[model samples]
Target: MTDRELFDTYRRDVYYLCHYMLHNAADAEDICQEVFLKAFQTDRQGVERIKPWLLRIAVNMCKSHLDRRKRGVLKELKHFLLERRRDTEAADEALERKENELETERWLRALPVKNRTVMTLRYIHELSLQEIAETLDIPPGTVKSRLNRGLRQMRRDLGKSNPNLKGAECLE
Candidate 1:
């Protein structure tokens, strides 16, 4: 596929990754745009691996943004944009789903940065072990270990915050 075509196909996934990584939709959109722009500016050889390359760029952008970030920017942006959606019955369902998603997101946000990234890349983005290893520049074995450890941490946290959820047993 051509660069634009591949980029279009993967755009939502890239945005989702950025949103998950940054924990804010607006910054995610910004990073997604930046990643695509970087891809567009790349040479043909670089464009050949655009999916993983774009993910790497998005990851780097989130990391940079996090490292020098001001507090509440992400939260304020999220709250500001939350009520601006179109009104409809289907939109109500969507809003409900968004609520659940946001709750899950809050749980994720409480985790360590590395665990959050690992969970987002492994579970949300649905990347293969090798692809995640490539994107994170880590070994496949390490990715697996991180996945296990992250899940364990998430379960423990969830059990504490959610009265209905039992730690680790929730997975069963």
Candidate 2:
């Protein structure tokens, strides 16, 4: 496929993957462009699955990006964002949105990077276990273990934070 076609077909996938991993729009956009630029430079004739290959690249890029920075600041920023009350037409809807945001942030904070990436691939991106393995270049069993461990950890973390929170139901 041409560069434009490749980009158009998978930009959202790539961007979201990066955004979810990095938790920053500007960083995700930068990484997404870098992913496509690298894609444009590489020979695609040998790549059988464009989406997975692109995602693998994006994943590696995000991991590297994460490694280069201190994570404390990002967590602080996210916590700050979650603390702010939004102005909305529907109080119930706003409450639900804020709840979801806080839940997501908690989940993200609870898991390690590897486990978080696995969870994101399985839950958010909706990739199968096998696909996650290939995208992360790990075994399928590893992917399953990561998911299980992440869910368990998240459940414990959520439970500790809120007595009424149904961690397993939300996680599963």
The best candidate in terms of TM-score:
2
Model 1 over residues 1-172: C-alpha lDDT tens digits? 6767967798987887777667777888888888888877767574445566678788777778877784322321122223445354486787786886676777667666666677777677677887888888888898888888878876776677677966456664
For each candidate in the order shown, give its overall lDDT on alpha carbons.
Answer: 0.70, 0.79
For candidate 2, give the lDDT: 0.79
What's every prediction's RMSD, in angstroms? 5.0, 5.0
* Backbone Cα, N, C clashes tallied per candidate: 0, 0
User: Each model's TM-score?
Assistant: 0.71, 0.75
Top candidate when judged by lDDT against the true structure: 2
Task: Give residue 45's error in model 2 in angstroms.
Answer: 3.0
1-172, model 2: which lDDT tens digit per residue?
8999999999988997877778898998999999999999999999987888999999888778888975522231143332345653478877887787777767776678778778877876778898899999999999999999988887787677777768356454
Steric clash pairs (candidate 2): none
Per-residue error (Å), model 2, residue 46: 3.1
